[model samples]
Target: MTNSENSSGSILQWLGFRGARGGRSVDGKPAFANGAGNVFQQARRHLLDEIAAFLLTYELDVTPNNLLTAHGAFSGSNPALARKIAQHVTAGLAVTQEWLDEITAADETIDKHDGIQHLMARLETTLESFSKNANDTRSATADYTDELEQHVAELDQVQGTGQILSSLADLAKAMLERTRKLETDMRRSEEEAKALRRSLEKARREAEIDHMTGLPNRRAFEAVLEREYRDARASFDPLTVAFCDIDHFKRINDTHGHDAGDRVIRLIAEMLATISDDNCHVARHGGEEFVMLFRGISLSEAHKKLDGLREQMAERRLRNRKTDEPLGQITFSAGIADVFDFSDPRAALKAADEALYTAKQGGRNQVIIAPKGGAQAA
Candidate 1:
């Protein structure tokens, strides 16, 4: 077969379709069945059930993006992501929207979606223009007030002026007072707009960051990946991406309670951060997972470094200071892939994630390197 034909066949699996097109997706029926009056309610119901399960399971907010996210996880492409979520379900770990956002962050779509960021940006632009116009109008009104005051003075200077002059003076005073009020209102409106613009900026920054770890969240990482991918490919520099998961973290939470679990999570964050530098970027990718991006690094070299960290972590035993209860050895498993080897960064990320699963299945506390340029890393 031609390369195109091979790619077409492989895309079916990559896109979570089984057997052939217009057929099973993820499970039994096709995902996203054809619309335009097609008899596909059974498939529709199945997909709805999957969406509902995700919302109800995690108590996630009912939003269109959340619905789409869940659908993609359970019914659409990336069944591996669905499987990973199932593991969390089995472990009884708390699920957060942040976690879902992180793991599914590999969707290689551009930021063309109509979202709050675009909305806020438009609002800011409008407000800035409005504020400038308001200030300009205020300044013009102030100059007009000065002109009005001079006219009133000229009327007073007229010798032996009658009642007409008195009426003109009264009218001029009224106009002056009204102009002052207009200036004050315009100034107030400008200040309010400036304040709102500042708030929007702050909100935008917060949305891209993880509140728990104060690190770049999945949404932020997605932007980073896109930029780094371009820079890496252009410069012909090797870029490595890895996914890491804390081994038996839910057990830690279950045995020692959430407080201890929080500490363990923080400790892992710190340990991972030690490896971060200008060439390496690390972030908490939601829940018990962290993602790292490395530029100018080889795959096996990155693995050697991360694997060494894993061994050190495995050798250390922790304890809960609250009750002084002993906690078993804490360690993390990692899966890594070189970005240039894959057709795209998203494929590389999925491959790395599959390797992470191998590390887990092969017994945790180790790092696995995926085969070059393949979808199934392990």
Candidate 2:
């Protein structure tokens, strides 16, 4: 057989049809074979044209190009169909190259295009019917390319969404951590403030209290006296001062040790504190002496209060447990002076002291009142 005959047979076999041979005509050419070959060629041309038209309408560029090259040499004596297919294939290729160029030049435009699946569906139907002899190959290739591109685009979209979610999670975590730290700092500051307040309160208490007897000390007494003095000056209210000394306190300390003497002093301080009212303030002045400030009271009233306190002290017995003996029954000499006659605390105190001296001379355990504008008398 000639190469042309072999090639024709190959094309028929590719289309799944049998090539036929017939007896020679009177002109010595194969007469019946030529007619059959013409019929087969026409059918092939019809199928190619349908496929090419579909590819052009739907923009399947790559599969048509492959089909054109595969069947170009065998599509004989029908150069018109071959040229038509070639033109369509070229057009699709040009369109594809332009599309790729457009995508590269302006990526934002691609985002606005129909999604991958929609674009691929149009392409698949067009490219898959390009060759009647190899329809299965063309269809399979189009389907594979379409599905693959769609999968890739979907994966890209998923990845983009994942990135956005990750960034939001990071931002939320950062805000939570910041809020936690702020709360921790506030708690720490609150605790520090409470500690500082407690320290300040303790210091103020220490400043106001006497260390030895646990009563108001001389400084606190003076503060109260000054306030009472101002109020009396303004309202013309009566104010009085009483100075009292423990009788023979030095002898008591010399007889019983100083420890017993301290105990005796503490006992006397407790008794005085109990006997005094809110209008009166009692304080340990020094050594064995104590001072009382009275507001809105008379000299006669002061005399009665001091006398009662003295009798109470004399009746109480203080004894040392170690010695198992009486430390002593305590007694005090008291002097009262009116603040109306004195301009300052010192003058009042001096007047009261003179009265106390008289009381001591007259015999201890007594109340002495300074006669208005006169010396103190027991």
Q: Can you write out model 2's per-residue Cα lDDT over 201-282, one digit (the tens) per residue?
A: 9887788777778887778888888898898889987889988899999988888889888887888788888866778889
How good is model 1 by TM-score? 0.54
The residue ranges of model 1 lying beyond 4 angstroms of the native Cα positions read: 1-164, 373-378
Local distance difference test, each candidate: 0.77, 0.69
Backbone clashes in model 2, listed as residue pairs: none
Task: Report clash pairs, candidate 1.
Answer: none
- Candidate 2, which ten residues in sequence have the lowest lDDT sum? 14-23
Residue 127, candidate 2: C-alpha displacement in angstroms: 57
Top lDDT prediction, candidate number: 1
For every candidate in turn, the CA RMSD to the true structure comes to 49.7, 20.7
- Candidate 1 on 200-269: residue-level lDDT in tens? 9889989988877777888888888999999988998889999999999999999999999988888888
Q: Global lDDT for candidate 1?
A: 0.77
Per-prediction TM-score, please?
0.54, 0.51
